[model samples]
Target: MAVPFSHRLDWSIATNRLAQALTLHRPQFDLTASNPTNAGIDYPAGLLNAFQDPRSLHYNPDPRGIESARAALNLGPHTLLAASTSEAYSWLFKLLCNPGDAILVPRPSYPLFEFLARLESVEVIQYSLRYAEGWWLDYDSLERQLTPNTRAILFVNPNNPTGNYLKIAELHRLAALCAGNNIALISDEVFADYPLTGDQTRATTLGDNGECLSFVLGGLSKTAGLPQMKAAWLTASGPGAGEAAKRLELIADTYLSVATPVQYALPTLLKHGAKIREQIQDRTRANLGTLQNSHLRPLRVEGGWYAIIPTPRTRGEEEWAIHLLENERTLTQPGYFYDFESDGWLVLSLLTPEADFAAGIAAIHRAFTA
Candidate 1:
């Protein structure tokens, strides 16, 4: 008899044809990459010498992670270190949800979320983030998506691709939503450290809120732009947080996945990481200025490293992306890829090298006008 695979991983290969086509084609101006290393930003390497600490040679593993490293991340007395935010999310799913339980995610957000939920045999319901003057949560639609099976509500503060922040009002509403519901609130704040608009609140973290069981996640991936280091963490706080922390501690301990060198050097990486983060933020501001000066008039990005431009749609969104790729040799992501409810939207990375981003914008302009 043949072995069977799980149905959860079964997904359509055809939906990714545009991406696959561009990959096989000649080198194109890639606007889809958010990876900071390739974004042509300079980083401070002096702090990396901390990894040479002789103590790293000793295998010291803790289920809750090293206290000093957790302190470096601002995760307070209780912290669970994971190899990455991706792994942290996986752990959260394992800790909170049983098979077939559901979680609420944002629509017009990153597509990776649904895949992440699926990996844990968890269902995902997407709530719309209505964009007007700025993006705000569509609470009515969100309430409709919630059910008894819903174990948690996840927010990508300064969400990926759209770059929308969870404002104070939205945070208040969410806190109330989770209050007395016995539900967890997970805020993926990896991009929280990057705010395009000057935010009144400095890095709004959800873990400290005493309303519900909340988790605020971040890492060196975006905060420090060190993807290779593989360091990330989540801070669990709020009511019943202590109990959940114990369970999550056990789950994290089972893997103890983070490397000793990264854990030992996290403090230095973060200290120097701030310098690179500023560089990247400046680059994002410059690109935003370029967009503002042009006819594109991108949607106001409150925070995060990506921006979206609503374009005239002569054709379907997918057709537009393919046209931009084939005609302009400029690769861009279609808005629908993020579960956007509308058409005529193209997403671009602010992290693209300055000149390359300008050229991609020029190409897009030409294609749209031509």
Candidate 2:
């Protein structure tokens, strides 16, 4: 007897030798550190006290996660938690789609969603974001991509690596479009709190958007910078949300992947999460200033942890990334890695340590001005 392995499992590349070298003792400034734990940020005092609490010893497990934890999220009356956002995506895929159903994703965005969809045996449809004044959805292309098999359209609020968010007006339009097409609007708001702008219209979250069947996802990973805690949730709202949430809970009952410790700690963790976010924001804002002193033009980001910078069209993006590593001892993400529409673009993580980030930015400045 043979176990059939899926082709999707074979997909990822090594995360570059520079990252490996940094792990070994090589002197390098990695500007792609997205993990807040690794980015040298300080969390609030006494946060660790929640972890070893006596309450975690109880074996009480709820399929939708512990009630208090889910309630703490305040997303809605309907909520489900998972090991991480990836698991949340998988649960949602199973909840909404048949094996071959497709979901629309944004280009020039993080590559993780494509892999997540593939793992669920779901197809991904690409919809482009035009970078005119700033990154905005291409409505014509979006309209053209929907088909009978399209079950949902996903948006990364303040999208990964590109940082632009869905505007309130755009949300209204998209929700109406989804309502018309019978598609669910899935908003991944992991980066929702890190808005680069103070304008609330551009920084809106999708939890309360009532026009469509909406599933808003987020967790401790981005919210509290605690990926190791393995706590994430999905919230449902809109027409038939009550029934859909019940079905989702039944699916979640099978996996029940969240740990009791993390569940019990949710209250304290979310409370202290604000300080961690503040530290991260301070670093990203300061580094954003340092990153702009060079010839490369930085794209306008309304919010999120990553920044996209434009480079000159001299070589392949990978070759430029290689040059940065070899010559400057600095590492950056090649634009193509994020499915960028063209070359001459690179992504920098605002979560990087300020000194290291500044050094990497200075190196880019040297290359541009040289």
Candidate 3:
């Protein structure tokens, strides 16, 4: 018999076939590129020199990571380091859940949660983030999804494709709900630093959340535009935070997945990494301006590195994506990929080069007008 693989390993998708086939032949302007390293942003000189610290030659393992690195984060004494945010999620899942328990995630957010939950034998229930003039959490829908076995609620602050931050009022309400139900809050604030609009009401971070047991996640990925560094962290706060951190420390001890060198270099990386973050902020803002100036008026993006463009409903989102790829040689992601409830929406990466973003915008305009 063939090896009995978990159902989570099933990775077939038919929707991408057309885009893959066309890209094989065409030199396309890929507007879906979000990786800063792959994008054309210039890095600071000798940024890698930070990794050469002599302290890295010695090995002293701490489950919470090196004192200096954790101190550099300033997330407080309850912080723990992980290899990446994905690993952090896995660790959190393991810490909080038993097999078959459920967690509430936000709809129209990144689709990675389901897979991550499934891998841990946990279920994912989605709450709504409906969009009108801007994205707002549907609190009623969220409360209804809560079951006796609901262990946590995971939300991406300034969420992935939707690009809306949790408002101050919203955060307080969510904290109260989680506290009432005895559930934890996982706030993924990886994209918190990249703001495209002036939204003073947005909740910048959940590190200080004191209403419930909260875990705030951030990393060099978006902080410094250094995803390759493989250093991410989670800070536990609110009630039971000390015990939670102790349990999380046990989990981190099992893997020790974060490298010693990265931990040693973190302070330096964070210091020099400010320049890269500035560059990314500038690039995303400039590209967002390019989109707003075009015929297409993208949705109001309060922050983050993505913009949602509502295309004409003359065709389905998949058809529109394929049309753009086939006719315009411009690649974009249909909103359905991120679980947008309706059709006729496309998501573009604001990290795309300005010239390519403008050209892609023109191609999109031409496609609709023609």
Candidate 4:
């Protein structure tokens, strides 16, 4: 008999299989591409030379990361480093929850939370982000979802696919709620730097949040458009933050997974990374405008590198995606991929080169209108 594997490792979705098979058969104009390196932005030549620092050749390990790199974030002594935001999530899960304890995640946000939580034997409860003119947290539903076993609440600032930031008022309310309920807040702010609209009311970062215990996650992945470098930070704040930091330090010590060269290269990468960040912001903005001006209707996006286009309800999201792929050679992510509350939504990455984005938009338009 074969050894049994963890139930968490036992799943694969049919849509991914279909997409892979289709791509293997023919070329696809893939609008679902989110990787910055594949997005055709002009990264500065020799930008990675910072990793060559002679200091990195010497082995020095710090549980909270090397001083220079942590200092580069300017987030004070509360910050800890991880190889990636995914790893940061794993560490936070371990730090915050015991087996079968729960965390609250936002619906219509990135689908990563469930997988990350499951791996740690933590249950994921979802709160709603309702959409009408814009996306806002359904606080009533959020409160209703809370249980005594809930240890933390995770939300993406300017959420993936949905592209809506947590408003300042919402943050205040969330802080109050978490404080009252004794739940920790985990804010994923990787895309906070890429606002697509001039929204002054959005909460930009949770690094200084003091109403309750909080963890603010960010990294070069979205901030500097350098995902390959593998550097991410977690900032702890709010009441009992010092204690939280100490515990997180112990968790980080076990891994010390961050590469030495990347830690040393962080300052240089962040300083010179401004140009790359600008390029990404510009690319996303231009593509968003193109999408807005097209015949298709897209939800209002406040920030992030993705936009949601609502397709015809006559067909399901996956069917529409498969239709476009088969007929127009265009690829899109079905709403189910992000666990959207309803049907008729398809997600597109705004990081595609301008011309290709436009072409894919036209193709989508053609597929639907025909």
Q: Give the per-residue lDDT digits (tens) of candidate 3, residues 25-110.
A: 47368889889999987887888888889988888899899999999998888999898999999999999999999999999998
- Report the lDDT tens digits of candidate 2 across residue range 1-370: 8998778687767776545545654438888788788878887779988898798888988898898887788777888888998999998999889999999999978798889999988999999887986899887889899999999999999887778888888898999999999999999999887887777667378766778999999989888888888889988999879998899888888877888998989988999998888887788888777766655678887788888888777767777777787778888888888898888888998888988988888897787566
| TM-score list, all predictions | 0.96, 0.94, 0.97, 0.97
**Which parts of model 1 have CA positions greater than 4 angstroms off?**
199-203
Residue-level lDDT tens digits of model 4 in 88-138: 999999989999999999998888888889999999999999998999999
lDDT value, candidate 1, whole model: 0.85
Which is the better candidate, 2 or 3, if ranked by TM-score? 3
| Per-model C-alpha RMSD | 1.6, 2.2, 1.3, 1.4
| 1-370: candidate 1 lDDT, tens digit per residue | 8999898888776747687767766536877768898878787757669799888999989878787888777766667888999999999999999999999999989788888899999999989899898888899999899899999999998898778888776787788788857789999999988888877743377667767889888888999999989999888888878888899888988898999888889888988998999999898888888777777879978888888998785787778788888888888888988988988888988888887788888888888788
Candidate 2 vs candidate 4, lDDT winner = 4
lDDT values of the candidates?
A: 0.85, 0.84, 0.90, 0.90
In angstroms, what RMSD does candidate 3 have relative to the true structure? 1.3
Q: Which stretches of candidate 3 lie over 4 Å from their true place?
A: 11-15
Q: TM-score for candidate 2, please give it.
A: 0.94
Ranking the candidates on TM-score from highest down gives 3, 4, 1, 2
Residue 223 Cα positional deviation in candidate 2, in Å, after optimal superposition? 0.9
Off by over 4 Å in 2: 1-4, 10-27
